[model samples]
Target: MKQGIHPENYRLVVFKDMSNGDAFLCRSTVNSKETIKWEDGNEYPLIKLEISNTSHPFFTGKNVLVDTAGRIDKFKRKYAKK
Candidate 1:
């Protein structure tokens, strides 16, 4: 490990899973303008996430669709010519 390579501004931040509205507090150096009052009566930086371990298909053992880039339609169109 090299010195000065890690950020010293690691503070408790609230990460919310936007898909499921689940929020958890953890140390993070990431910056966010949004703030939310946590359960501990403290306001923390809110980071909205599309998926988390709780809502992910791999962790929850369920099929989930995440189409941020329309890859499925592109693939189908490309293969439909055959």
Candidate 2:
């Protein structure tokens, strides 16, 4: 263990906003422009996520098309050989 040579480790919150819902949980990640109000009415570093366990189809047991933009089709058309 070294002092003054390692990055700061602090408690932070990760917020997930997805098609299923939104949730907040504690994590340790870096963020430059995210903030969240804690239970004690204090602001802390926050990370915004698009997909998480709650919204993931595999975890929810729901068959869903996660991609709304035709990205899969575009990829196939571009890479798949005729």
Candidate 3:
């Protein structure tokens, strides 16, 4: 591990899986404007995640399509001209 390269602002942050609405607390330095009241009665930075292990197809053994941002549309438009 490299010294002085690691962030010192590591703190407990709540990550909510948007697909399953699952929330979990973990150490992170990510910034979030949202705050959530945890079961411990404390507020923590809320980070919304589109997918996590709880809802991921690889982990849950289910096929799912997560189209974030209009990536598919952009891909088609860019290649359609060719």
Candidate 4:
């Protein structure tokens, strides 16, 4: 609702979910050095994401654990009752 406070450089950008390899095109002002050819055969700026609506547990209604570098195991070992 403010004037001159919004970005005027909105451009089509492809957001790719690394977890599910899902990608979608949307307008964004974020900068990226990578580009991807979309389904429409048009090149767009590519933005790699670790998780998105497609692969997110909250959005997909699936309780999944994504453990990296043995974090879950380390937590269990540290907090486990002796």
Could you tell me which 10 consecutive residues in candidate 4 have the lowest summed lDDT?
Answer: 62-71
Q: Name the TM-score of candidate 4.
A: 0.82
lDDT of every model, 2 decimals: 0.91, 0.69, 0.92, 0.91
Q: Candidate 1, residues 1-82: lDDT per residue as tens digits?
A: 9899988999999999887889999999999999999999999999999889989989999898766467899999999999
TM-score winner: 4
Taking every candidate in turn, the Cα RMSD to the unseen true structure, in Å, is 2.7, 4.0, 3.1, 2.2
- Writing each residue's lDDT as its tens digit, candidate 4 over 1-82 gives 9899999999999999887889999999999999999999999999999889988889999899655357899989999976
Worst lDDT window (10 residues) for model 1?
A: 62-71
Ranking the candidates on TM-score from highest down gives 4, 1, 3, 2
List of clashing residue pairs for candidate 2: none
Question: What is the per-residue lDDT of model 3 for residues 1-82, given as tens digits with 9 covering 90 to 100?
Answer: 7779988999999999987889999999999999999999999999999889999889988797666567789999999999
Where does model 1 exceed 4 Å of error?
Answer: 66-82
- Which pairs clash in the backbone of model 1? none
Tell me the TM-score of each prediction against the true structure: 0.77, 0.58, 0.76, 0.82
For model 4, what is the error of residue 82's alpha carbon versus the real structure, in angstroms, after optimal superposition?
A: 6.3
Model 3 stretches with alpha carbons more than 4 Å out = 66-82
Candidate 4 stretches with Cα past 4 Å from truth are: 68-70, 73-82
